[model samples]
Target: MAEEEVKLHGAWGSPFSKRVEFALKLKGIHYHYIEEEVLTKNKSPELLKYNPVHKKIPVLLHKGRPIAESQVILEYIDETWKGYPILPQEPYERATARFWARFIDEKCWPSVWSSFSEGKKEEAIENLKLLEKELEGKKFFGGEKIGFVDIVANFIAYWVPLIEEATGKQLLGEEFPALCRWKDEYVSSAVIKEHLPSRDKLVAHFRARFPSN
Candidate 1:
């Protein structure tokens, strides 16, 4: 018998959705994953009813109440489940983790996305440098082991590299060897490595949607 009814409304390609999915899987939670084709206008009424404002995918319905936003859903999963805690137990460490997570949300992710969309080469390189400096000597964003911050930081991994390939430019430079190494470590995690979108599929998807120069 199932303990709680969990359903996720998310699109296949969305990194936000992938984050939520990874957190759920890490907690060993049984969930029904409904792939919402938001771009194709295939959202369900329940999704709209739950997240009225954004109406975005990656809505986690616990029992019946829906939670929007991938980060929030991750915290919810951590709090609701007792197994394999994704967040640290100590308050200070938890605060630090949250700070880095928010940092990625506010600073890193936006910069990367902007670079991807507008072909802002110089600005993208600058942002990537900042990230590299910030992550110097750090094993993961949250330190030794994979945590919430690592999950958020690595969210754009699949897309950013694809963007660079499409544009024929490497935003992650050899100068930032530490950050590049960190990226490899973060993505090579058993869970992340297994669940990430296929490169060929993503390249094809982006080529069709965002044709390069």
Candidate 2:
């Protein structure tokens, strides 16, 4: 493929946006990144046109077409660039990887985020425990090498510790030793370490967003 213009429309604090950004960086793809302010009602006209249904941020505009959903965008980047393959090449392995990725994106993410609210502690802990069990004794969700599922699972790990600190409730502890080690490895990776959001900023943002909780 010849040199093409790629653009990402995203918000700073959004994990969805960060996923795409990490993929792009890992693949050594040079693209323009437009950070959107999603807190307010206003959204960029480009974003509006790209994702008409969801009207959400983290839209990846490749050439002229736009792709929403972080996981979809990550696949697009890997397939298009062929630089750093995020998804496994084998058919069954690719399917397995995608399965876990979707699980993290759909189930684990919602449960983890729900912990921030009042009256959701029990449910959140149960959900987190399930994840811990699934991840027990695993270096990465995809084994040794960091793959698509690992990336998606660890998207919120950076915030989870701080959330625990803020709320004084530790969801990940000795009970999930492997998971804790995995979290450390995931965060320490160059791609994630460089691009992760500021901890102080995230704490302040969440504190303001959920003041009572």
Candidate 3:
């Protein structure tokens, strides 16, 4: 491959992987897409070499260098590409954006991911409401546009709902109308919708993974 080439190693059903795609598309960068069979634990040698520690997908190979971790790769994409920006411009704003993204990955998403367990739903809703409150007076965590935090929270907008359906859990509901509205707005956008995994495929993936649900 040429030194200037860009390649993305990812799985189709992964929200982490797709967030990187969202950034690349927004930046109008053309990249080769390499699918890794992550679900079956059949990681490729290339993916292993690129992300040896994680042994996972969503590794971005740009200019002959490997960048792992979706969040890290996102910042790299924004900095390396010229058109669209995933992170904010101002120093304080950029820090705040990173903070919220970290909160989603560390706090909110974890709470919801385990909410199916007994007595965990309340904790999950509490964390979700924290995010809902953050969305106040803004269309997205990125304000009027989609930014780093919004991309980080893509799992909540798409995957979490499917998890609720597959697990028969009530994490998202009428209690948070603002979040519901934001979810629809985010997922319905032409840029995001164009690349989102089909609902049928996601539902089937969820069902197959959690058959007991």
In model 1, the Cα lDDT at residue 141 comes to 65
Off by over 4 Å in 3: 1-4, 117-119
Off by over 4 Å in 2: 1-4
Alpha carbon lDDT of each predicted model: 0.79, 0.80, 0.87
The count of backbone overlaps in candidate 3 is 0
User: Number of clashing pairs, model 1?
Assistant: 0
Q: Give the TM-score of candidate 1.
A: 0.90
Worst 10 residues of 2 by lDDT: 118-127
Please give the RMSD of candidate 2 to the true structure: 1.9
Against the true structure, what is each candidate's TM-score? 0.90, 0.91, 0.94
| CA lDDT, candidate 1, residue 19 | 89
Backbone clash pairs for candidate 3 read none
Model 1 bad stretches (over 4 Å): 1-4
Clashing pairs in 1: none
Query: Local error of candidate 1 at 124, Å?
Result: 3.6
- Model 1 C-alpha lDDT per residue in residues 22-97, reported as the tens digit of each score: 8877788888888887988978898899999998978999898899998999899889988877888899989988
Model 2 C-alpha lDDT per residue in residues 1-213, reported as the tens digit of each score: 333579899988787888888888888888888888798868989889999999998899888899998888989888898867799999998998888787777777777777666546666666667667767878877777677877677655677887776666667778777678888988998888999888888888777767775
